[model samples]
Target: MGMAVVTLVLAIPLLAALGLVLVPGYRTPARLNIAASAATFLASLTLFVVEPAATKWFVLDAFNIYLIALTAFVGLTTSLFSAGYIAHEIRIGKLKPLQLRFYHAMYQAFLFTMLLALSANNLGVMWVAVEGATLTTVLMVSLYRTAAGIEAAWKYFILCGVGIALALFGTILMYMAAQPVMGPGMAAMTWTELMVRMPEVNPKVLNLAFVFLLIGYGTKVGLAPLHAWLPDAHAEGPTPISAVLSGLLLNVAIYAVLRFKMLLAANGAAIAPGPLMVAMGLGSLLLAGFMLYRRRDIKRFFAYSSIEHMGIITFAFGMGGPLANFAGLLHMAMHSLTKSAIFYAVGHATQIKGTQRMDAIRGLTVSHPALGWGLLAGVVAIAGLPPFGIFMSEFLLVTSTFARQPLLALPLAAGILIAFGALVLRVQQICFGAPDGVSKAVPVAWSLLPLYAHLGLVLVAGVWIPGPLVAWFQTVAALLG
Candidate 1:
């Protein structure tokens, strides 16, 4: 019964998405999409109330339960944001009703993909789910059919497609690697079964599998060198889509990578996954830190920030102590909330300004004070400033890193400082000083509510995590090892 409910929770959005495309009325589809997403979130809430257990093709455990809840929660909020955002796009002639229909359908499909990736008990199923998300977003990214939008969508499709293909190869290699020990059957490929039998798997096969999987899923995670598709996708897609890309999609991708890392760890003789992840994590941090100073598009700027924080989280896991792992988990949750909140504000700002060019956008404080300040607060929080959950999590990551590897601390600190300065400079230009042009006011009621809710949650978590949640995180972090 539990497995059936969980499967239904994951599948509802995909079914709704198909209905959204086939159904005629716009308002009805929009309402249905929002209601479906909200119900999905409510169903995921059962994770906290229900005990941990495995069902035939799925498992409910500490490691994934919170992420399931978080993904569903963010999916609901983004659906609400999309409702308003697409409506505004139609109102302004930026998008036609036909495109809005595509947008609505694609949005639900994207949610369904992420949910599947999170809940899958088989590694191959998880990879397939991640690939499914990549395909859905390609359509959404190109919904505008503008030159830039089309180009961005193509780039996203090509890169992520190739990356996911590599990940699939890695998955196959893992299966092959496990077959000798666990025997060639479905039993050899199940994540839980593999974890239990991993110690007996060949070390050489595990090492090679890790290398391929890292570069493959790492692309989806937006790690550097593999990250070229991210900025264009963010710059051209609907802002609500950008919100989910940074907030939810990237987290889902990282989750895929972590699952593989767990498999590698279980094979005791395999080369430690820590050093490779650490190197990639540090490399992404340094690259994104330098790249931050040069972004002209606001969304692109934050996309790089997503890369930077993912690096930090990757680094935390790479460090591999209980404290670092705990901090990594917290950072992932905090980054998803804070980054998505920022994108929410950015979406509204771009809409009001009628352009994404940084220079064309100025004096957001005068134009849309609610959105302007919300972006500013989100910026402050994401830059690892105090009173935000990111700051506390980042502080813990750095402290843990310093204790173990003091020399690497300088570059880490430098990256944080550089990102901080760049974010403040661009944000100040947009939010304050002089009015850029004629100002337009959006309804403060709907747009600002989700932004503030996310920010307030990050803030509260920074000050203190409730006992139940903290305990939950600690348990999950232990499992990460």
Candidate 2:
């Protein structure tokens, strides 16, 4: 039953992608897209109830189950938000009806690839899935067909393509490392088998493989230095695509890195993966914090925010205690919900204001109070302010860091302060002051639902984390070590 659920979850989006292409008209595909995504999310939820035994090709466990659920849920909500969003785009003539059909189809394809990447037990298969996601997103990023859009798409393809190629080599090295111990066959490449037999694998080879995997997956995670493509892609793509990129795609890439980190942990002689992650995470946090002040485009500003938060999550995981791991997990969930909500609000704001420029979008509260407040709440949550899930997670992370490594906490706190100031500063300018620019009303339907629903959850989480969630996070946190 569990495997059936898994298969169904993976198949729905793939089948929907194909069906969407043949289905005529924008409204039909849009509705079908929401239906299919909701069904997938339902199937993914079943995993939490029915524990599936590890198979030769796939595994259901503490680590991936939550991520699967999160991915599916976000996919569903984003599709809901996209329905209304795409309608606006069409009405404005920014996108044609034909392009809408293609957009809906490619959206499902992107979801399918992300699910495949998350569920695959074979390292090679997971890499292929990630690459597939990259390709599908590249198409979506270029859907506008504008020179800037095309440039962003090409840059995304070239950079991530190179990263994926390096990842492939790393996967090959992992297989070679396992071959002697597990024999030269499929079993050697299976994650379950590799985990069980990792200690016998060559540590030096595992170390080298990890390096390649980190750089490869890290590129997708939008970690600094390797994150050049991320801002442009987010800024140039459709708002819905930007939501998925920041919320789901980056999480999946981090998941891949976490999987490899586990393998390295199992190999007793290998260097600790924690330090490497910490270094990269710190770099991303500091760099993105400083960069955030320079963003004129709202989407790009939030894109940099994504990079900064990803850095914090990475830092938490790198710290490696049960508390830090738990913090990382919580932060991941919070950031996903909060950031996507921010994007949804930002999408509508940009459309209503006739621009993505932060300077042009002013006094949102006065112009469209609901959206203005929605954006305000989202920004506050994302900025790691009090009474939001982000604040809770960050608080735990900082205190945990201070307890274990007092000096390291200094830089971590510095990054947070820097990012918080930038976000608050920009948001103040956009949310307050005199009303400016166009404030035409866009139909508020299921679009705002996602924003409010996500914020409500974040608010609840800040005050109280449910027992089951805490326990699940505890289990996963133990696994990380």
Cα lDDT computed for each candidate against the true fold: 0.87, 0.92
Residue-level lDDT for 65 in candidate 1: 84
Off by over 4 Å in 1: none
Per-residue lDDT of candidate 2, residues 296-329 (tens digit): 9999999999999999999999999899999999
The candidate scoring highest on lDDT is 2
> Which one is best on TM-score?
2
Query: On a 0 to 100 scale, what is the lDDT of residue 116 in model 2?
Result: 89
Q: What C-alpha lDDT does candidate 2 achieve relative to the native structure? A: 0.92
Please, what's the RMSD in Å of model 1?
A: 1.2
